[model samples]
Target: MLIGSLLDEINKKIQELMGKYVILDAYYIRLAVYKAMNLQGTRKDSSITFMVDDVFYVLQKCIRRGISSLNTDCICTVINHANNILLTEYTEALKKNLSASNWTAVSQHLLQGELNNVSGRVQSENAQKKYITHLNDVESSTSCIIILHNESSEILQKMYLSDPPKRLKVLSCLEAFLQTAKFFDSLLSETLLKTCSTIFYKLVDNMLQGLLDLRYVISDEELLMTEVNDPFMHAFCDGLKQVMQPFKKYMTDTNYAKLCRILMPYIARSYEKVVMQMKFNYNGALRLDKDVQYLLSFLTNLTGISVRNKFYRVLQITCLLTFEKAEEAKEFLLIESDTERWPFTNKEAREILTLRTDYSEEIEQLL
Candidate 1:
């Protein structure tokens, strides 16, 4: 009876501290809850089950108040210990006894908190690259990927339903998915790729739309300046590159062809818009050549005849500008147009060259 009374008193004080001090007294509350639960004693005394329930009840109340109200470290510690206890000692019993809603809320809070930790740690340029590489190692070990796969359906549903900011927060974990794809042997990667294809398509679509929307707010001059000086385009391109990095090894030829088909039209349209705008703004000054070259450097990395053709057309226009050096333009065209030397297969090269001839007459007229 005295021990039970002490447990009750501890629970009461924990509730009081959480209600009053919130984050400031989270340490005390955590310690009090741990002491009241007395996990070691619970292992021996089945009667201590009630006390354990009371501890979780208090945690649920604190969690309901808002996960942010507690110190992150305190919450993490509590969740780790709680998960250990629940998984080992109370898994079957808790299903019958505990409130399902409370359990779910606690689980979600912990998962989201951990995911946010992963996101927060990789905000800088160098950190972002390093984190992606780390993902490859972690996924290969199956630790992070297993955790993600366990929650993937829920995460996907949440992402589909969430508002943009919330969805982006969830989608930030995509690097993990890419790493998983990279490490999977071809067959498994194909299956996961199909499952994730819609999500990736939507992500790329949204990103491209954001880039295109920049045209409305800024003049050609400001847009050029943004292309040259801002990090936004660099980040977007880098993200796409990261997404494709794994495909080189894991993607089958058919999947690669499909991916090219999906991406080519978007790339072509965006390139056309930029080139058209530049052409409209042209006044025989080479001021925008840097912008053209910047985009070209990134676009050249993409495959497909349509993309290559658009790039060639853009190069043709730039070469026609009075300020462009004829020798440099000729050299670029000669090097870039040799179908034999291109990245595509012989059959693909022949097809692209055949397609290129249709535009040849028009390009000559423009020149």
Candidate 2:
């Protein structure tokens, strides 16, 4: 009974410290837990024999209350500090047999709390209020989005550069950033689009190296002939598609068209390689076909009418090549070679065919 009373008193002290400096208090409490468990030296063991759960219970309560009472700037500061703790301290401590679930609970509680606070602030500021209030709200929302983008970019960079990489964490962080961007776009509209566009551009630039690695794999004829499922390639492409998904709504047609053009050549080159591999390996070709199809579907949705129609024409040619029926391939070649009878104008056909050397060569062979 006396020990229980002491623990309760200690809990009250920790809460007071947390209320004073929430972010720093989290680190301090974690250190205190380590000391209380007598895990200062080589006395490390496999089990957590201390009352770490009770400590976390207290910490969770403190984090919740602190988040509720803080303003936007304070909340952002706390979030940034919490993320640092998760990435550095939590990771190291977890290896020492600390409670991972509890740490995750605390970290997630902080992140979700931050999300809720920012969301509520956005909604409240954007509510049908006075003109001066709305303007102020827009400014505040813009600042919050910028802060979240920076945090998310740090997470993405870590995930991208880590040895063997943490794909799930990278994706989760990306989704979180997208949610923030989506919210800003909905509330602030064009005022934030330029900033959002720059964020996406940087995202794609960071992922470009990974995309190039995948391209190198696809360009390898021998590997494509042997491997049935290129999981790495699929994962990378899917990730790129996911990152680009949120931008579709906010992007101007001109901007979208530019992005489509930039991406089309990569798709075309990959398709060319896949089609060449299909000549010798039917089963492996089937798997790659799905990759190409997925990319095409994504492009079709994002592209303008001119580009979409060109993709449809290319899809028609791809279908013909897949079957490898000599007669149908010859018919397609003959029809497309005729300027008047071709579905696209001669210039458009050339533009499409130039996207893939294999397509042009195959048509030339049929002619």
Candidate 3:
């Protein structure tokens, strides 16, 4: 019999007996119920399989409560069997019932289920299962809880503070940094971009500082002033700049300068790749005069170079001199146009060439 139906039958019997007996003892009543249930299902020494289709089915329904007492010896065994039988049905029901409010619970439960490894974890098994479950429950449906992060950070901190190896700590710090960033993105206000920037900078600072024990981590002080190469650093710097772009409308000159100072590291880091790409190849050889002049001036000032004198020959032919001289100078400087081959594609390559030539001419004029 169904557990619900059995429960209903037991409740009815209890009601009827309550009205019949003047001094009905609770213990005797309970024992009578257990005995009646046991008679319906054969009580084997190994396992208790309650037969629901037995005769006197109405009275045998009392076995529902006795199952608990009977489970004392083989509760795990019963749970295993019960779980095995109900697992499929439970998951199907859960899938149909999932919603945004309960996504977090579903994600957690699914993760735990994966860890249990009932469905084996192959190369992509864990990732694929997690991907499917996450996509279905959170990503695609937008109706499930987002597991932005787990307990990875807490575990990392404890490991680091104790006696973690240097290599292990570095990796842990990197993972923690990424996880914390993701967590903040999911939780923080969208308008609080600067707030996120500050947090991001702090994380970078922490990561760099953590590597201080390594010789290579402490780079040359001059190298710090040099342009950056890491794309992540560039992105971080750009993000800060974008966040503070609107501040000038409200900020005082002094406040703006202060903000710029705060953003300098980010800007420099982010601008490094662009600067290097510009130095490589610039195709706007004869046009973009103003842009070229600006780039030259900017580079000269930043690099402490008097481009007017340092690169006078190279710039002169590229701008004021003959086309032949310009061609010769380009060859001298190994200035091959990066976009010459990928004319129809490579948007970034085109932009770089345009910037590079302008900057090159500006530097020549300044020199």
Ordered by TM-score, highest first, the candidates read: 2, 1, 3
lDDT of 3 by residue, 30-120 (tens): 4443443344222343111232112113222222222232222122222222222222332232234322223333333433444455543
Backbone atom clashes (below 3 Å) for every candidate: 0, 0, 9
User: How do the predictions measure up, each by TM-score?
Assistant: 0.28, 0.29, 0.18
Q: List the residue pairs that clash in candidate 2.
A: none
Writing each residue's lDDT as its tens digit, candidate 2 over 20-93 gives 77656556656754454443222133112233333333334433443454233333444444344433443344
After superposition, the stretches of candidate 3 with alpha carbons farther than 4 Å from their true spots are 1-245, 264-269, 278-282, 285-367
Better of 2 and 3 by lDDT: 2
- Cα misplacement distance, residue 18 of candidate 1 (Å): 82
**Cα displacement (Å) at residue 165, model 1:** 70
Worst 10 residues of 3 by lDDT: 140-149
Worst 10 residues of 1 by lDDT: 130-139
Q: Model 1: runs farther than 4 Å from truth?
A: 1-201, 211-230, 273-280, 283-289, 302-307, 310-367
